[model samples]
Target: MASESSVWNTCNYSRDVTFFYNLVGKKISEEWSTQDFVVIGLGLTVCLIVVLANLMVMAAILMNRRFHFPIYYLLGNMAAADLFAGIAYVNLMLNTGPWTRMLTKEQWYIRGALIDISLTASVANLLAVAVERHQTIITMQLHSNMTKRRVVLLIVCIWVTAIIMGLVPSTFWNCECDLDDCSTVAPLYSRRFLIFWAVLNLLTFFIMVAMYARIFIYVRYQSRATSEHTSEIRHNQTVVNLMKTISMVLGAFVICWTPGLMTLLLDGLLGKASHANSFEKYCLVIAECNSLVNPIIYSLRDNEMRRTFKWILCCLCRKGADQRRQPSVKINSPLSEETLDFVQKSEDRALRKPQDSHDKDGWTEPRV
Candidate 1:
């Protein structure tokens, strides 16, 4: 349907090798402009931040014995998922960056598969965290037999499901958008697959919402029983904190994933899923930003995590300050306001409940 001259600079090569043509029936080279470099530079910076933040999360969990419980284990797994997703973004940026060339069909398949696995794993971890909280906190289960081995097995199952969900469709599904009959427009089958993926993510989001709603119902009942006694008052405050944490987790998930999900839905349904547009790319960039926010949401309000983060930051800052020959500056003093606040809060909470407070970030309290 296009003009004969628009077939491309290397039509034979594009067909045999790339098999990817633009909507106007031509192949676009990987040449990038100043704006492209700026865009990619910003993306790379986010990727670096995501990796480091999640790594700090993982390190904090590993170094703290109080975090060895099932909930923190699940959270650590979520951080690991984010870490891998960040790495995948780095790889993708390389494949699609200024120095890039046309990718063969196999490269496309692999890239899509990796992205799916990373995202699906993250979703699965969130679901698992929700379910775990529902079981232990709201239901008031006195004991859990969920050992580390069993937890590892459960995480393995999650990854296996993610792999199947991600790779199976790409390998077996029929779609002109990714096949020899391809043009810029996405075929019917391809559109269906995109819709299906979006619906699955939506379903998971609904499940998490339902679980958190049940938790709130339980917390509300506890609120009624809370008396003027100090411990009871602390419990009531804990409930409020739990509610806030749930809100943050849910809010962050929706904000980051919604753009990417909606874009896929609209693009596939409108039959333009195959063409690489800036809108789609930017939507995905927003989705990647989700990884950057999780560590903040997961660690910021958590007293212990906040302290650990502060410690690390001060250590790094102190080193920097010492290099500048500032001898009188004391950033490492435990008597500082930040340290005193952390210790006071820790002691206050420890008086009421002592064992595991990491779940404060995830909304888990012993009493229902």
Candidate 2:
């Protein structure tokens, strides 16, 4: 039976969004079953891993001065979205299954909105990254000349767009007044809204794919044209490798999310008879796994990211070992303050080289 609570019936426009489907056939058990417990345990475990892994990615980028460029900043933002996804999924898991039946309308809406925002942010951030890369690669630059202020503004705009998208279902389109129009997967949500959301994301995926395809074509042509210039060839090769890594990330996202989006589409079109809810659990699990896989892809496919991860991990280990051992006594410096100043100045000069010259880490900052 459809919930006829005042919350759902009071306002036709206030049904909130959710990325997951509710359990349809099962009654709320008074006691947690072994299966439910197992599911919760595994889900929480994965969420924790997702949180830590993404945290490490963000930390690595933030702590390393070499990673303070536009591309790395965008990547750090992606990690932030994944971190949010991990937190959102934890909330979903805690409130799902038996706990779902006990939640009030407001609580349900909050639960759903968290997941919606996280997912929308993830999708929006990916598109932003794609656009950023397109602008840079098309100009044969290693990174864009976007200033830190512009990057911050871009990030803010991404979250704002995501928040608007996440809330749109509840603000404008819902089935609260008409139960017949309600989705089986999300009783409070309008079928039209699901159809719209699914199609929109699918279109975004296609657009990103097209952008990457153009980037690859241009890079291939550039490589051939610059074959005689050894240094230029190396630069092109670096761009290709980075593009391949990012493409893997995009490919994994598409593979993991398409099924879930398709399920939403099917439910939106066919309603109750679609049997979409039966597969909803599986679909959501797969979708959630996408968040977990991004960090792995970054670590595996990017040499710089992998090296950063190792350095961070080693630092942590060394710190632990140092705490176990007695602190070393301070020794008087052999060099005077003037010598130290000269060394520092030399290092600063090396770091401040022109964009065309690579730094110690072999990272080149591209000029606009």
Global Cα lDDT for candidate 1: 0.66
Write down the lDDT of every candidate, Cα atoms only: 0.66, 0.76
lDDT (0-100) at residue 5 of candidate 2? 75
**Candidate 2, number of clashes:** 0
Which ten-residue region of model 2 has the weakest summed lDDT? 15-24
Tell me each candidate's RMSD, in Å, in order.
7.7, 6.9
Candidate 1 Cα misplacement greater than 4 A, ranges: 1-17, 23-30, 97-101, 140-145, 174-189, 273-278, 313-368
Q: How close is candidate 1 to the true structure, as a TM-score?
A: 0.76
Worst window of 10 by summed lDDT in candidate 1: 180-189
Q: List where candidate 2 sits over 4 angstroms from the true fold.
A: 1-31, 324-361, 364-368
lDDT by residue for model 2 (170-282), tens: 66676766656678777767888899989999999999999999999999999998899766766777678778877887898889899989998988999878888778889
The candidate that achieves the highest lDDT relative to the unseen native structure: 2
